[model samples]
Target: MRESRAKSVWLQREPSPAAAARVFCVPHAGCGTGVFRNWPPEHGPVDFLPVELPGRLSRFGETMPATFEELAADMIAGLERYMDVPFAFFGHCWSALLAYEATARLQRAGGPAAARLFVSSQLAPQDGPVGRMLGMDEAELAGELEAMIRDQGGTPHPELVAVYLRVLRADVEMSRRYVVPDPLRLTCPITAIGWSEDSEVRPGQMSGWPACGDTSFEVFAGRHNRFVDAPRELLTTLCAGMAGRGPSRLPVTSR
Candidate 1:
C-alpha cells in the first residue's frame, strides 16, 4: 500500500504475491479506499488494490481531479511502477470512465494494459449524459441527489455522506466542465456492469462497450450503486470475471 500527493492519491493492497492477476479497484467519486477495505481479504484468488483519491476521506486537503483525463493521467503515473504483473481494472460510476482512460494511459506508457476492464453504473462516453445532476439548480439537484440515493441505496455513512456529498458536488462540476482532449480508445476487453434498475446506464448504451474494446455486459437486479447494496454478489461477479470465467448468477433477491 502506497500514496502519492503528486497525483493526489492513496491506495491499499491485499497482496497475494503468488496471485495470477492484480486487481485495481477504483472507487466512485466522493469515495475512498475504505470502501474496498474488506474486499480483498475475503475474495478468493487475485490481489486487490483499492485507490483513494484526494479531496475525499483522509486526504481531503489534496486537490481532487477536475477532469477524467487528468485523473487518468494521475492514476497511470501512480501505478506505473507496479506494471510487472497482469492486472485488471474495476471502477464504478465516474471511476468507470477513469478505468478506461487509465487503461489507455498504461498502454501508452508501455505496459501491459489491464487484462480486463470492468465498469459499473455508467454509460459509455458517446452514449451521452444520463442523470446529469451538475446542470441542475440547487433545489432540483437536491431532488436528483435524493433520487440517486433512493435508487442506489448506497448512501455513505451519515457523517461521511455530508462530506462526500460536498465532494461529489465538486466532482460533478468537474465532470460537467470537462473537455475531451483526443480521440481515445483501448484494445483491452471491457465488461460493463450495472443494475437492472439503473437508469444511469441504459442496456443499449452498455452495448457500446465494444467501441472501447472487446466487450460484454452483465446486469444485476438492483440499482446504481450495487457495491454498497450488494457486496458479496459484486465481489463474486468481479472475481469470476477476472479469472476469465463466467459469472454465477444470483437469484433476484434485493438486499
Candidate 2:
C-alpha cells in the first residue's frame, strides 16, 4: 500500500530498466502530467518522467499542500523510491521553486542527491517569490487561465476554468509566501534555462542562480511556454547536462 501510494505521484509506474539517468519533470502552476504528453519517452539514455502533484488531475481528491516546504516534503516521499539511479529534477515556473527546495532538503538530509537541478523560466529562490501572477486579481487571473487553455487548443469550459482558478490562486499564494532571503546551496550542479522571448520571467532575472551552486545558464529562442513542446534543443540540453557536458553560462539560439 505504501509503495502504491508513493507511485501515485509519478505518471510512469516503472523506471526504464536501461536508462542511465532519469529526468523527473514537474509541471508549472495549476497544471499536471498531461502538459508533458507531447514529450518523447526517451532522450538518449535518459528517461523522462512527469510528476503529478496532488490536488490536480488523477490526484484531484487529495488536498493541496499548504506551503512550499510541505509540498517539497511530499515530493521527496513520492520520489524516494526512484532515486536509486542517477536522476535530475526539471521544473518550470513555480514548480522550479519546489524542485530547488526538494533538492536542497535532500542534500541536507544526507539522502541521495540529485545529479542536477534544471530550473526553467524562474528566478532563483533568493530573487523570488516574485512573478507577475502574484499581483493579478481574480478576474485577471481567470482571463489569463482561459487564455492559456485556448492557446493549448482547448476550449475553456466554465466548470473546469473555475476549478483551475482555485488551484492557480492557491499556487500563487503559496509562491507569494515562499520568500527565501538566504537559500541553501545544493551539492549538485544547476542549469538555469531562460526563454528568449519570455515576458513573464526575463532571462536577466535568472542570473542569481550561480549563487546556488555550480550553475550554468542557457537561453533558448522561444516564449515561456515553448519548453512544453520538448523541443529538440531542450532535449539535447537535458541529456547533455546529465552527462556533464552542458555549455556554461552562454545562451544558445535554437532554430
**What digit string (tens of lDDT, one per residue) describes model 1 on residues 168-225?**
7777776665544342577666777768777666544565566666666677677666
Candidate 2 lDDT, 118-153, residue by residue in tens: 999998899877888989999899998898887677
Q: Which stretches of candidate 1 lie over 4 Å from their true place?
A: 1-9, 37-42, 139-162, 178-183, 229-233, 246-255
Worst 10 contiguous positions by lDDT, candidate 1? 246-255
TM-score of each: 0.78, 0.94
Using lDDT, give the best candidate's number: 2
Candidate 2 residue pairs that clash: none
Candidate 1 residue 132 C-alpha distance from true site, Å: 2.7
